[model samples]
Target: MNRWFMTLLASLGLLLIVSGCSTKKDEAPKDPKAAAYDFSNEKSFVVYGEGIAPVHTVSPAQAIVLAKRAAITDGYRQLGEKLYGVKINSSETVKDAMIRDSRITAQVNALIKDAAITDATFKDGLYSIRMEITMSARRWHELFSY
Candidate 1:
């Protein structure tokens, strides 16, 4: 009887230790490549854009595809806004002008011939995209010279 009781106690202790040392399943996995890029340099610019597609008559795969396409287009628009700059009439605040009359905002006419897509992600039914734009000295001179 004494030996049986000792064995039971040892088994309980072992179970306790094993359960306590287990890692949490709910913890988010870390991405090693997320921090690989440095955007502090003034020579380069980074922009992010996101798009959400409503679940309508389309299947899940189709929805995701549409969302990704929208995200890429939105990213390009954001990059164009950053590069060409948005013009608003002085008579009204930019926000008000945008809300009341979108025509007040100058359209981007300059061509963004090249843009690098840094990252693309989909989570919680929304698609997000990141873009990086680098302007060389010659490109800047060409843009201004025209």
Candidate 2:
């Protein structure tokens, strides 16, 4: 009876393992908003970012340049977030069943290559930039392998 029970348990475990195995190619993005875009119909991803001129800038030209640089940086950050999902760390302290302190942090790390700035404009002391990157099905896998 003991040997029969062990065999049955091992078979069930093996079945579960086999059923859980899945290929990475079919896995979809975890973010629900990702569903809005029909990636199958498109070959690239697009992101936009805006930056405002700081009050302390010396000249209008300098302010414009600064804002444009900031806008480019913002666009890159957005790309990183989309490619590599954000890492969130949270902690909470409870005293007498009441939460005393809580903290949450998010971080993203990604390597963006061959991204092109399609549109850029400065208006009313603000700079806006649109960035697009060409991504292939297997392109992302090559990014982190290095």
Candidate whose TM-score is highest: 2
For model 2, how does the per-residue alpha-carbon lDDT over 54-110 read when each residue is reduced to its tens digit?
Answer: 889789889999999999999999999987778999999999999999999988888
lDDT agreement with native, every candidate? 0.73, 0.84
TM-score per candidate, chains pooled: 0.55, 0.63
lDDT of 1 by residue, 33-133 (tens): 43223233335668887889777936888888888888888888777787787765544435744654333445664467667888999999899988887
In model 2, the Cα lDDT at residue 72 comes to 93
Candidate achieving the largest lDDT: 2
In angstroms, give how far residue 34 of model 1 lies from its true place.
36
Error of 1 at 98 (Å): 20
- Candidate 2 differs from the real structure by a C-alpha RMSD in angstroms, to one decimal, of 12.9
TM-score of 1: 0.55
> What value does the lDDT take at residue 29 in candidate 2?
74
Per-prediction tally of clashes: 0, 0
